[model samples]
Target: MSGTSAGAPEPEGALEPEGAPAPESAPGPRRRRVPRRERERQILDVAVQVFAKRGYHGASVDEIAESAGISKPMVYLYLDSKEGLFLACLRREADRLVGAFQGAATASGASPELRLHAGLLAFFAFVSEHRDSWVVLHRQASELSEAIAAAVAEARRAVMAEVADLVRAGIAEGGPATQLTDEDADFVTHALVGAADSLTDWMARHPDQSPEGVTLRLMNMVWVGMGRVLEGEAWKPVTG
Candidate 1:
């Protein structure tokens, strides 16, 4: 009648007329393609959260992938395994911390003391800014697999070595009065690292304290004792 008869079938395999544009198919869901570096960073960020919350043994690839809005296969493809992912997080955080320390330690033409002050400030600032990273690097990594522990330990040792070097320079520049035997420097370096690590927890709790304040307090505590030792003062217990 007026229009095509009801239920009339169109011709099979109708084709577009020559010189006419074909009808476009409906669009499918768009696949968001993240760059490899950016995707890896996203995965690592989620992984750190999972690891921090669950610990190494409790953290799962599925959870990490789901949290990252990626597939488990994608996580494995990017990081190989859970341990690999944890190690990646450790390396990244450790590198960041060591780099911060090094940059602050050497960023100025200031004296060794000032450089050390800068380094401590950088360290506390890093801890304040990246508490998750600190937990991952400081706590979780140590309790994970042996391979992970070794990797974290190596990073720690590297930072410690750098600190020891700074101490050595300070001693050398302090003239004969501040000179330290290699053994003594090594001892002091270990002690200093230990003290900083312990204080980092305190700093986390005491958010009101400025990094500069913490650094200055630590410097006062360390340098005062160190100055005495540098002048060859030794403490001995009184015998009964």
Candidate 2:
């Protein structure tokens, strides 16, 4: 990662174009100059779509620039190259995901269970709405150069760290979760994140399941067991 991106490993990114300020464009003789930041955002927006649809190797600077209704030179100027553009996409989606979870989970006055529920809900909601971004984040990260792969891995680390913090907070709050130690929290973090990741496929199949609904079900499966087991209801082996 050190030598990537013209000597810089990676950079943080922009909104996912839901309500991003529209780029300035004109069909008239006089064209307004788009601000550099807005222009860069426009490029990245199109780039994410292209990379998701065409993948890392198949997508190209020419097509991305054209699709954004801009010139290739401007793309290079803003993002450096295709790899740079991909890295920005990866980082942006990662930020959007982590941001969603943190914002929901940290809402003032919310209990730990509610916070975790909100966080998990946000995650499923994100995957549902931003399928293309998820494609790039989930599927396309492994098929490129080493630097890009490392950056993708870092994105995963960021998500893992957020879940780890949530687990620690849940442990701090007195509850059935209180029976759990930091080590237990660590294990829970692994379980929760892994389950959520794998469940994206399950979610794809069952589109009828709302994010809130899915979150509630996961809570029942996990949090309920935490409570039940703390009440001396641990599972025991059957004697032969």
Find the 10 residues in a row with the least total lDDT in model 1. 1-10
- Candidate number achieving the greatest lDDT relative to the actual structure: 1
Candidate 1 Cα errors over 4 Å, as ranges: 1-28, 177-179
lDDT of 1 at 139: 76
Instruction: List the RMSD of every prediction in angstroms.
Output: 15.4, 5.8
lDDT of each: 0.77, 0.76
CA lDDT of 44 in candidate 1? 84
Tell me the TM-score of model 2. Answer: 0.83
Cα lDDT tens digits, model 2, 41-124, are 677789889998988899999999888987776666666677888887887887898889888888834566777888899999
Tens digits of per-residue lDDT for model 1 on 1-240? Answer: 122211224454433223322222346865545555666678788888888888888889988887887777766665667777888888878888999999989995567788888888899999888888888988777766888889788999988988888778777876875657888789878888899999988887888998889889989888778878777788899999
* lDDT for residue 145 in candidate 1, whole number 0-100: 83
If scored against the real structure, what TM-score would every candidate get? 0.83, 0.83
